[model samples]
Target: MSRAEELKQQLKPGQVYRREDLTPYSNAVDRHLAQLVTEGVLDKIAQGMYYYPKQSVFGVIPPEDEVLVRSFLKDDRFLLTSPNSYNALRVGTTQLYNKRVVYNHKRHGEVDLNGKKFFFCKTPYFPKKATPEFLLVDLVNHLDSLAEDREMVLKNVIVKAKSMDSNKLKYAVRAYGHTKTKKLLDPVLVQMKSKAHVH
Candidate 1:
């Protein structure tokens, strides 16, 4: 078999790959990538990103978000979420957003991958999964960017904070909260503390 075929044989369906990953398979990496793309063996999802589509009985199955992002960032340590998820909290945020937010230690800013926009937020700390407490804190962190009435949402946040486990919420606020989020949640958390004293 030829070098191109050797490289092509390395591709696994439903996998997202960065250019560096295929370099080991081919010395003429770029040339082989172009050949594979031309032959429809690989789909170029974004600049320097490629996907080997998985075939289903219905048709072609797109690469999963986790797979695409893991390859794009080249790290599995990232949290994927959407602002639209805030609606699930029922804290008066009802707007639907098309944006997907990724919290990672490496990259920040927005990039389009496979026609979807992902906003990368580089943070020193983030939970492996977006817990309820984390999402609540994240909602307040990005409150200003939301389309809702900011003051009204904050009011609801205080109420929601009271309903949550004080210790867990406090931990989330301290660990994941942005500066503004810290300030916003601080007073409510303190109030919870004082109320505990009263009881």
Candidate 2:
């Protein structure tokens, strides 16, 4: 196969690639990339970023948020979430938000990737995956940004906190909570611990 053909052959569907990643496959990487994009072999999602479109019965599946962010940041250590996920806690959060939040060690502020917006938060700590307890702590951390009734949400949060594993929730509070969140949740967790001991 020609150098350009070999370059195209290296692409796999449902994957995102940085320009540097494909450079080794072709000497004339830019010309090859431009041709591939024009031929619909790839989509230029952003500068220096390309995605090989994956097809399904539903048409082309957009690059996954995980893949997109992972490539954009060039770092795999990121937690992608949004306020919309808070609704799963059933703590009176019903609003659906379009915002996608990324917690990572690098990149802070909003960025656009493939026509979607991601707000990158550089945090010192974030679990590889979010646990329910972690989400509770995060909810309180970002309460000010939420559109729901704050007082009502707090009331429900306290009640929900009671039903969760006291030890796990307490650790989450200490590790992930803001000063105010930690203060609000500590007393409740202590009460639960004491009550459990009493029984």
Candidate 3:
């Protein structure tokens, strides 16, 4: 088989690939990649990055957010989340956010990958998936950045904290919450305990 054909065969639909990832398969990787783009076999999402679009009844489908970021970072050690998701917690966060946040050990700042903007936050801590407690902490941590009433949100957070599992909430605060989040949540947790004793 030709070099281009071999490389194409190796690519999976709905997957993103960097030029370096195809190096082992061909010597003229760049040229062949351009040719594939011209042939509409591959969609060039960014410089040196390509995606094999998945076909559906509607049309071509872009790679999922996590899939794109995992391939772009070339590592799975990152947490994918949206601040808008905090709206679900009903803590007075109702505005929608355009960008998704990626908390990872490497790569800081905004990145435009495959036409989607992602904010890569370089932090030492992040969980594989966000828990309710973690999400609460995260909401408070980024409260300043959100287009909402901060003081009101804080009050709602305290109210919402009442319904959360005390042990798990404490653990989440200690493990995932930042110093400010800890400080804010401490009183709420204490209130939770005080109320518990009353009952």
Candidate 4:
């Protein structure tokens, strides 16, 4: 089979890939990619990432945030946290916040993927502590498309907290300290505690 055909078969919508990923299939991936670019069959989203131009109807195709998130994950193990978790809670629709994608990484600082922005917060913990308030606010944002029972979701959050490594959680709490996020979480925490007691 042609190198182009093989690459085409490997491509999936909303999936991010690197040029190196194509190496196993064909050594001519770069040449095939160059040819596709000249033909307007593919468009580069970043250094090594490309997307099929035809799949974009308006010719206004943009980089997929989730794809970028996955790319960031490839570099290091990260937990989707803060603004990102909040964004996911409101799943079906786009996030309203102006902030970039947030992740709890083993490393520190921020990295931009393609045109999308990602922030990596260093956390000593594996399963990080996500306060109820923050989680709820994110849930409220995505309430329109939620598939899980509200009670079940709330229970899961508490369970997650209980299962978290306490030392790591403490380290994260110290690293982040108190801020707007914690302030925002206050009421939600109260409500969750109240609900748990009632049930």
Error of 3 at 33 (Å): 1.0
Off by over 4 Å in 2: none
At residue 7, give the lDDT of candidate 4: 71
Candidate 2 residue pairs in backbone clash:
none
Model 4, 71-164: lDDT tens digits are 6456645555544455344333334554553445555677766665566666544333455433544454334444556455555544444444
C-alpha lDDT values of all predictions: 0.92, 0.93, 0.90, 0.55
What value does the lDDT take at residue 156 in candidate 3?
97
Please give the lDDT score at residue 47 for candidate 4: 80
Q: How far out, in Å, is residue 176 in model 3?
A: 2.3
Instruction: Give the poorly placed runs of model 4, Cα more than 4 Å off.
Output: 52-63, 75-77, 81-97, 126-199
For every candidate structure, what is the RMSD over all alpha carbons to the true structure, in angstroms? Answer: 1.5, 1.2, 1.5, 9.5
Against the hidden reference, what TM-scores do the models get? 0.93, 0.96, 0.94, 0.51
lDDT tens string, model 2, 1-199? 7777899889899999999999899899999999889988899999899999999999999999999999999999999999998999999999999999999999999998999999999999888998999999999999998999999999999999999999889888988899999889989998998999999
Model 4: which ten-residue window has the lowest total lDDT? Answer: 86-95
lDDT of model 1, residue 126: 93
TM-score of 2: 0.96
Candidate 1 at residue 71, lDDT?
95
Task: List, residue by residue over 23-134, the lDDT tens digit for candidate 1.
Answer: 9999899999999899998999999999999999998998888898899989999999999888888999988899999999999999999989999999889999888889
Candidate 3 C-alpha lDDT tens digits along 63-160: 89988888888899999999988988998889988979999998999998888899999989888888888899899888888899999999999999
